[model samples]
Target chain A: MHDKLREHIEKIVPLSDDEFSFVCTHFSIKKFKKHQFLIQEGEVAKHAYFVVSGLLKLVYTDDTAKEHIVSFAMEDWWESDYYAYFTQTKATMSLECVENTQVLCLSYEDYKKLCDSLQKMERFFLEKANFGFVGAQRRIISWLTSNAKERYDQLLKQYPALIQRVPKSLLAAYLGVSRETLSRLAP
Target chain B: MHDKLREHIEKIVPLSDDEFSFVCTHFSIKKFKKHQFLIQEGEVAKHAYFVVSGLLKLVYTDDTAKEHIVSFAMEDWWESDYYAYFTQTKATMSLECVENTQVLCLSYEDYKKLCDSLQKMERFFLEKANFGFVGAQRRIISWLTSNAKERYDQLLKQYPALIQRVPKSLLAAYLGVSRETLSRLAP
Candidate 1:
């Protein structure tokens, strides 16, 4: 698990063995069963999780209780109610395990400590944040321009593995289309 | 204008006089008339702009000649074809002046230099990127859960000044609605 984290961080900024050990101390590993909630709406989002294994979904539930998939995190991906995490506010969204999951969790306090102590980690996080923003912006563009079938096709082309792994209903939610519409769009 | 940039950065990370001077060295000021392009599709995006005055719109033009407003950047906001700027690729989007605009431009190489030389700037940028991602995520959620009228209302509620400033046609484009639909949604 630690090796997975080290490799993930090293992809952005190489870490010495000593630095890697120091980084490991800031994160604690946890396991969750499939369908378990990592974060729930109205609760404070305390930590950001880096997935070592398995899958997680960040979902926003509307007034009528329709769940909208905000994002999915798989191996080596980071997931959190980030707005809540950064602002120390109650989450408007929930994160749940889609598969039996193992994640390395870093609390906001420890995240700050790591950044203050190590310049490399701050650079790594900046890179992640920039790319995260880019990905979200791309999705916004897709929403503005593409219809359900086009979005589904783009998703299949971009992440065939994710398409295969996610249930159709969830994919429908993620794409902001009805399950029936998604079924029509998909094979 | 430098004061605006300093104030913006200082809001996230305080910088000394010397540090601010060093930061200023990496940026150059440029002015554009309304309808001028800061970035053009298929051209390499050489710099990211920090708006000191006026407004800019980042736009994506679809194959059918329809334009989608990806975002609007007004005073004290950053605007760029970020994917292209970050990757040194040709822009998929175009950035244009909505109002006669003045912006501080940071070339990618100078941006790297600033981040490498000043840790505080890197921290400041990280903070910006995080909030930028949060804002984009909120927009995605709105797209998923809200109808055209609801989205127009939300935009008006959140950015009343922007609503007053932006043309209704562009607002319609930003909301992914037809101009006729936006007229019905708006006052």
Candidate 2:
């Protein structure tokens, strides 16, 4: 599990064995069963999770009690109610396991400590945050310009594995389309 | 102009006078008249602009030649074809002045130099990137949950000044609504 994290970090910045050891100290590991909640809306989001295995979804439930899938995290991906985690505020979203999952968790304090202690780690996070922002921007552009079929085709092309793994109903929610509409796209 | 940049940076991380002087060395200034292009699609994005005054729009034009407003940048905001700027690739979008604009420009090389020389700048960027991601995520949620009128109301509530400044057509483009639809909502 720790090896998975070390590999993820080393992709962005080479970590010396000693530095890797220091990084390990800042994270703890946890596992959840399928359908278990990692974060609950209205609770303080305590940590950001790096997936070692399995999958998780970050969801927002609207005033009408409709669920919208904001994002998904698979192996090697990170998931959190980031605004709540960074601001130490109540979560407006929830995170739940889509599969039996294992993740490495870093609390906000530990995140700051890691960055303060290791400039390389800070650089790694900076790159991640920049690309993360870019990805979100692309999604917004897709929403502006793409029809439902185009969105479905783009998702299928970009993340074929995700398409296979995620349930159709959830995919509909993520695409902001009805399940019936999704069936037509997928079919 | 440098003082405005200093104030923006200092909001996240305090810099000594000497440090601010060093930071200023990494930027050059440019002024653009209304409707002038700062970045054009298929051209390399050379710099990220820090707006000192006036307004700019980042636009993505579809194959049908309809333009979608990705975002608007105003005083104190940053604008660029960021994916192209960071990756040194051709821009897929164009950035143009909405009002006669003055901006401080930082090239990718200078941006890296600033971060390498000052850990405080890296920290400041990380915070900005994180919040930028949060802001984009919120916009995605709004799209998934709100109708045209609701989105317009939310935008008006959040940035009253921006509503007053930007043209309604651009606002409609940004909201992924038609001008006819926007008129119905705002009127």
In order of listing, the candidates' clash counts read 0, 0
Instruction: Give the Cα-based TM-score of candidate 1 against the true structure.
Output: 0.99
How high is the lDDT of residue B125 in model 2? 91
Error of 2 at B143 (Å): 0.7
Candidate 1 chain B TM?
Answer: 0.99
**Collision pairs in model 1:** none
Q: Which residue pairs in candidate 2 collide?
A: none
Residue ranges of candidate 1 with Cα displaced over 4 Å: none
**Stretches > 4 Å off in candidate 2:** none
In angstroms, give how far residue B152 of model 1 lies from its true place.
0.5
Question: Scored by CA lDDT, what does every candidate get?
Answer: 0.95, 0.95
Q: What is the lDDT of candidate 1?
A: 0.95
**How would the docking of model 2 be graded?**
high
Question: What DockQ would you assign to candidate 1?
Answer: 0.95
Tell me the lDDT of model 1 at B42: 99
A180, model 2: CA deviation in Å? 1.0
Task: Give lDDT tens digits, candidate 1, residues B1-187.
Answer: 8999999999999999999999999999999999999999999999999999999999999999999999999999998999999999999999999999999999999999999998999999999999999999999999999999999989989989999999999999999999999888886
